[model samples]
Target: MTRVRGTPSPSAPARDDVTSLLRHASLTRFLIARVGSITAQQMLMLAISWHMYDLTSSAWDLGLVGLFQFIPGLATTLLAGHCADRMHRGRMVAICLAAQAVTAALLVVSTATHSVTREVLLGLSLVLGAIRPFQMAGQQALLPMLVPPSLLARSMALSTVVQQISVIAGPALGGVLFAISVVTVYLTSAALFCMSAVMYAFVRYDYIPSPREPVTAESILAGLRFIWRNPLLLGGISLDLFAVLFGGATALLPVYAKEILHVGPQGLGLLRSAPAAGALCVGLILSRRAIGSGVGKKLLIAVAVYGISIAGFGLSRWFPASLLLLAISGGADTISVIVRQTLVQLETPDRMRGRVAAVNTLFIGASNQLGEFESGVTASALGVVGSVVLGGCATILVSLMWSRLFKPLATRDALR
Candidate 1:
């Protein structure tokens, strides 16, 4: 396998040494690419949700939007994964961004014409979601190629930070724009998507996707087999899958803004961004410091912290307490994400990265939307506080169960 220059090859001394880890130039370029994409994604999501709710005034509509996006991921993931492996990664990303741009344009046009409907928005969301797995899988697959195996963790950490920034800024910006005019928000999102497309166009990597052997059932199954066989990948992904599926608190933010918390639109925006702010802080810290020898243990512990923080947030009636708890939860969740992303990038091969990453996207997308669904349904049944608190508790319980069932993921050697 060809390695990027100025990087410590896997054969080199362990990357515990800081000097060796900081030498790669491609890492910078790779991070730039990820940041660009993440910023666009965050902005788009923020704008879309804001517009959707403004038009529909229904929590069920929001839940349905989440569902629309996630359902397509279930269908296109393997096929997208296969394409990622067979095609050029950079071009594939470019194509995805272009598609996003088109979607954004359509949204703008629809909104401008006052022709936007919940059904149209939901249909567009599903299409975007279908293409999302491929984009995400392609990017994850391409990262390892840009940097050395040893720095994969750090690279993912940096990307996480950038994403957090996007998360923080996007909604706040979207909210401001939405207050000005819904059409303005849509236009801004479209512009951001175009900016991302342009940034991706400038990435000068030789990213021809790896060519796998001829297509067959066995070839398609190869990626799944690899993920299934790898204890670390399976355990980490699964742990997050169940953990986030129950613990995710996003769906309730709208409710908090509208009813329980009584903070209003600004509060809603802040609530949306609270987790990302915490994650951004954690990301900055991780970028400078090594994750240490016990990254596995740290990941588990961080998630536990996430659960505790979320539970605390759920129980809080005070706005400040709620915000602080949510921020803390976000920080803890960031740690788990960095660890998981690092392990996946390091362990998966370039050829199968798309498939594995698509699978990863599937889990993530499912957890995100399903979490929303679970929250929505449970909230409808149990009240907001009860639902959120229960979800947080379920996350902790799931973590404990996963630790017992897949204890090997908690060791550093599993990653190696």
Candidate 2:
């Protein structure tokens, strides 16, 4: 049968893909909780970083905050992953969020009582860090259950957008509140976490228990083996791991605000928020459009762009120029994130998602916290600008090397 000359195709309705995904009740509730909890976490991070720097005025101390948080996460990765696969994910997440809320509340009380100390902050970081992996692994595994397989990419993209939005708003709000009173920032964060817990309680999804396997070294090692066996997954995770490890500039933002940029707390907030704003914009675009073919090449190109932008930011003295560069870097990074996360989730089985996600979390923790520690140490030796510029250059080199090393990843044509 011949088609009409001006007739639209069957795929015309697909233009509203993101809206369709959001219509799922479970997914919608999850997104709301994700946004609120993530925003509060971001806000708390800024407040803690600022407080630490104000207390010690040392880059090493700033780095130590990340290190402190990371140690607990590292120590708990395997066990957390195993638990997520077997446990009630919603309840697990709710409990973790409640713990965080309590931590924030403690901070509020400490600040109000004139008893806030670096030791207390570090201790709280350790607690939160320990709980974070389980929370993340459960959430990652739970996501697939909320939507059909066809909508998985869109769901991930939308979830990322919510996270980016939180990143944008959280720090800005924190900065303003922090300027008024540290206690106010802590109290606000605690309230937000409580709100997120309530939302998590309302999310409804059918849980499927994975095949029972005795908890042992061999069972725990399965996730690592799976990632190792899949070259594409290995490459994607390592690329992100190395790129962020070398290119991270966040740890030194306070230095830029005080010594180099000469902008105070508000300016620091802008600096921190710039990247997330950029990521949010990109996430919105990707939610409407697919990445299409040549996924591997696109990921590599985005990472290289991220490195170049980061280096540009490092060298820029003007605040506006720096913000623009960081935004560019953030946008580029968002592309890579979407690609990597899609690859991991689509490739892994539901039963194994938690463990695989846990491994992914380890890479993330290393790239972020360990990277911050690296940045701090290097900054102490090379100065802030020099360290950032060098790290960015290293990131560019990593993208180039990884492209040649992981041929499968470079040659990948589709996410699935």
On TM-score, the leading prediction is 2
lDDT of 2 at 328: 93
Model 1 agreement with the true structure over 1-416: per-residue lDDT tens digits: 45765556676665544344445655555565666566667667766665677787666677777888888888887777787788767677778888887898888898888888888989999998898988887777777776666666766777788789888887777667767776776677667666666655555445554555786777766778898999988999988888888898786787777677887666877888889899999988887676777778888888888888888888888988888898898899988988898888778767678788878878898889778877778877887888889988988888777777777787664344
Best by lDDT: 2
Model 1: colliding residue pairs: none
Runs in model 2 deviating more than 4 A are: 1-15
User: Mind giving the per-residue lDDT tens digits that candidate 2 earns over 1-416?
Assistant: 11212323323343456877767778888999998999899899999999889888999988888888899988898777888888767777888899899999999999899898889988988998898898888888778777766667777788889999999899999989977898999999999999998888777776655677799987777788999999999999999999999999998999999889999889999999999989999999988888889999999999999999999999999999999999999999999999999899889987788899889988898899889999999999999999999999999999999999999999999865
TM-score attained by model 1: 0.92
Clashing pairs in 2: none
The per-prediction tally of clashing pairs is 0, 0
Q: lDDT for every model?
A: 0.77, 0.87
User: By summed lDDT, which 10 consecutive residues of candidate 2 come out lowest?
Assistant: 1-10
